[model samples]
Target: MADNNNYRDTTHQSDLSISITPAKAGVGLLFAGGALTMHRILCLSALLMGLFSAVGVYAADAQQSEPVDPGIEGSAIDKSAKEKSDSGGSSFAVWESKYFASSPDNTGPAVEQPIEFPHFRHAGDHDKGGMEINCMYCHTYARRSLVAGIPPVQKCVGCHQSIESVRDKPRIKKLFEYWDAKKAIPWKKVHDLPDFVRFSHERHIQRFIFQLNRPVQEVCGYCHGDVKTMTVARRQKLLSMGFCVTCHEVKHPVTAEGGTPIGDQAYWYSMRKPIIDASGIIKAQGPNDCSVCHK
Candidate 1:
């Protein structure tokens, strides 16, 4: 006997469907008495043919109605939504800009920091008459630790002491007070993630910039926005689990539709390696398990 699992039923979304059963058709035909005219048999045959044709067409339409792609749709990124923003404008970029547009963290005009540290002054450019300081200089522990350690008051003092460029500024006055007090500067957290998720700056930085040797902007731009423009730091992306998952998949993407990484000459991706602390016993492999993040 044929397996029931192999049988295809085409009864979806139809009020009156054509179900063909060999035994029933045979029995119904057999019951036709000898009094039945030849025209009646021909008419019945035509009706059956039409029903079969309808079933075939219905099946075809069902398949085309929905598409399944193991490589594209299965990823954390939404393929259908992505297609909508493919034209010159980036869908992810568009979403990132407005993700926290109206939140408390985002002040419509500007972010009010304890000290009005201008990112544009430090990370901007020589053309803008800005110092264009390297981010790592202030965020020293970025590549080596989970939390990108904030620059201490002394870091600011060390420069302002001699530079005296903006020495008399009120914010600079606040900096000197903290230095004199011998206390940690109370900088507010900007990119605060949920307590459940464990993010590693070491792993990401090592992979993208160290291993791949990609540019700093591309590496930093992955999560932090274009800080060169903003005077105060603010979040650019949603920073949700889905956002992290989508980026991770895209970075080392092997199953993308084009069989290539989702990057272009205009903006390329950073490639980083996983560090395994095996107590000098074995190399550590980056985790892909639920407990790794949740715990």
Candidate 2:
């Protein structure tokens, strides 16, 4: 009987030990799992740090690259002229190159338009069988508005309907189809800037055209290349920050000594107010403030 009682006591103790074993094992497993998770997190952080360091080095190399000059890259102006002519336009006209930078490398991809408007026929030199129409005649808003808005269909129809010359032309026929459909032609934007950038065509037009009394073509050529020679308008200038900054750094006479009045003082204010000199001349460069272009 004592032997049987001792056997029962041993069985009970064994059951109790078996029940407690899982709880101790669970605590140990939880600690081990946490250590493994921490190790994985540290490895991930090191990988991310390595990736960021590589990006920093690449950005540094890009920053050290040579700067682009506003002027065309050539030993002589004649060579530069030949380069421009070979790209798409005629021989280098000083009017086209005067205020803007032009290079074959800077030309943008040719964009396909809904109706291939013949700019060369309309705005090119009169000697080349062109009408020699002023740019402002079609793009009327450049002087007053922020954007040089596209002309309405009616504007084109007004002249085209009256003139029978080239009415049967394929491009003109496509234009007429849009007019008959009573739908606006979805002309693709050729020169597009980032959403963050704010450019005022009105401000530039006013300064270069009205205030400076520069030829409209020369002034417009500062951003857009010689459009007169192109069949369809294409981006010919770089239109980058470097291009703009290069032009802005060069000092321009604010008022050309009774040539054109600056008009309202408030209208001419850009990043900073212009300073008048002892010779009664207002000479200043373009707005260089970050807030001016970054808006």
- Local distance difference test, each candidate: 0.55, 0.61
Q: What is the TM-score of each candidate against the true structure?
A: 0.57, 0.56
Cα-based lDDT at residue 133, candidate 1:
80
lDDT of 2 by residue, 1-295 (tens): 1111111111122233344455545544555555555787765655555455545544433432223232321122233323333442321233224333455556667789899889989888899988989899998999899788899999999999987988899988988999999889888887787777788899889977898677787678668768899988988776777566544533322332332334644335442334455555553434534567778
How far residue 209's Cα lies from its native spot in candidate 1, in Å, is 1.0
Clashes by residue pair, model 2: none
Consecutive 10-residue window with the lowest summed lDDT within model 1: 1-10
The residue-by-residue lDDT of candidate 1 on 191-257, one tens digit each, is 8888988888888889777887766655776777677777788776557765565554333333222
For model 2, the stretches where C-alpha displacement exceeds 4 angstroms are 1-105, 252-285
Name the candidate that leads on lDDT: 2
